[model samples]
Target: MTPHRLGIVGLGVISAAYLETLAACSTLVVTAIADLDPDRAAAVARTLPAAHPMTVAELLASDDVDTVLNLTTPAAHVEIALGAINRGKPVYGEKPLAVTLSEGRSILAAATQAGVRVGSAPDTVLGTGIQTARAAIDDGLIGRPVAASAVMVTAGHELWHPHPDFYYREGGGPLFDMGPYYITALVHLLGPIRSVTGASSRPQDHRVIRTGPRAGESIPVSVDTHVTGVLEHVNGALSTITMSFDSTATVASPIEVHGTEGTLVVGDPNTFDGPTSLRRVNDVGFHLLDPLAGYVDGARGIGLLDQIRAPRRGIARANGELALHVLDVMESLQRAASQGRRVETSTDADRPDPVPLTPRSEWLAVQH
Candidate 1:
């Protein structure tokens, strides 16, 4: 089988992880690379024998490209995705889908009309850490999930990120930036959210960059720094979520799902694999569970690989429908925070099928 061709539209910090993961993939090849910075694109392209540096438009129009990987920032997600769809190319993008719910809808709608697939990130949820927890819940180890808690706290990305300006912009708040991982994992472990009630605050209007060449430079913060919300899942399960950039630190499990029988502590959903621990209703303490599901030694590009392979089997686990729903949950939560009322979601998505334990070697060897 011929390898699927991919055109990457951005070369940001996160692009390295995807490139590293795709480098060893036999089923996918990066054919074209583009970025606002031509030198960056050229630098990245030179590393891949099959890839050529091109303008965004040129990459989108390239005959060598079979699909477009939208790695642009949150603000550019919709533009790049829609462009790909309009050109009849499938697109797999980084998370948040778009800056606004309506923009997100437009991308999906365009993809539908163009008859192309749309996939999105936060694929971290498809890893062993979250998948193992999902397997437990499905096996009744958690006997009907009742509630969940997701917590992510930090002083701010400005402390480490070289270009942290986007982390505090319109599409870049604690809730929007980091919420996708937690909320997507919640949907995977529990189910789709029905409604949400939230409260948020922006205690600081400016953040100082503590690292990189921009060290000590202050950037304006236009979005909330602390966000807390309650998500009501369709199954009547409630999930409490806190995403904060104002806090110093936290020792809490990234996520904890409670049920009548036990509580599952899920590891960080931001990575491909993290530890998952469980403690039954009457258990003495939480015990670590070995990796029982998801792509073994998984990495960033696996979701795009999963999407590529979906045509041969079931739906893509990290698909656009799920991403759109997650975006809805997030936008709704923001609305709830600003309105001081419960905001019912207008979208829904089925829980993607659980991934059975499979090694990277096995998955990479399969023909799509």
Candidate 2:
């Protein structure tokens, strides 16, 4: 099969991670890159195998690019995606799809108008981490799932990131920011949500940075700093979600799903190699598993490290592909919520439902 050619629209930190993922995605290739900052584009260009750096316009016009990897910040997502779709290229976009639900709608409408496929973010759901867990539940290892919960708390990103202003603005907050990962995982495991009710606040006066040169800079808040919501799924499963940029405290047990037979402790949905643990109410031991199944040698690294090592993980060669699927679901959920209707999603229309696997850490081709 010919590899899907991709053109990336941004050279930010997130795009760097996407570039790294291509090492293991034998089916995808980065052929072009564009950024308003020529230097940033040049830097990203140097990292690719044969990438040609150009303006977004030039890249969009290139017939060599079959898909757009819209990694631009949330603010530019709508414009770039619209451009690509108008030209009949498929898209796999970064999270939130756009800075506003309105913007997301426009992008989706454009994709629909142009008859192009659109994929959205927080692809961690498709990673072996979440997929493996889904398989287990389907296989009856955890019996029938009844409830689940997820947490995402932080001190905010104004200090460490080079440009932190966008995060504190509207369209950027705990719910929209980290919400996709939690929501995407829940939908993947329990199916689409029917509704969500929530509370929000921008109560923090200031936040501290944990890393980088401006690590101690204080960031003022404009958007909601804390958010809690209930996802009422169609399958009668419910998910409790809590997110905040108000604290420096860490959260344990990123996700937990309770079922008739046992409980599953899931890894963070933000990355793919999360460990899954199952134990019945009266069980003596926790059964540990990696959602990636036969993929990966069972190493659990948290945060951006998963992105860094995904291309090299034993069975995570498919991490980038999984991310594409995850991006699709996250985009659909936002569109569903914004459009006041549930989305019917099927990019890979013929894909099979996941089959559960017994707990094991079988390794696959690590590299090469």
- Which numbered prediction scores highest in TM-score against the true structure? 1
Q: Each model's TM-score, in the order given?
A: 0.98, 0.78
* Candidate 2 segments exceeding 4 Å error: 1-3, 205-220, 290-368
lDDT of 2 by residue, 1-368 (tens): 56657788877777656665565455556789899898888887887787889989999999889777777777777888889988998776777766654566667677777866666676556556787778777778778889999888887776467667668765577666787788667766787555555555678756665567767677676666777656666678878778888887665588888899889988888876677888887889888874445234232211122232343543232222333333444444445445556454433212224423323222211221
In each prediction, how many residue pairs overlap at the backbone (N, C-alpha, C within less than 3 A)? 0, 8
* TM-score result, candidate 2: 0.78
Could you tell me the C-alpha RMSD of candidate 2 in Å?
6.7
- Candidate 2: residue 169 lDDT (0-100): 67
Candidate 1 ranges with C-alpha deviation above 4 Å: none
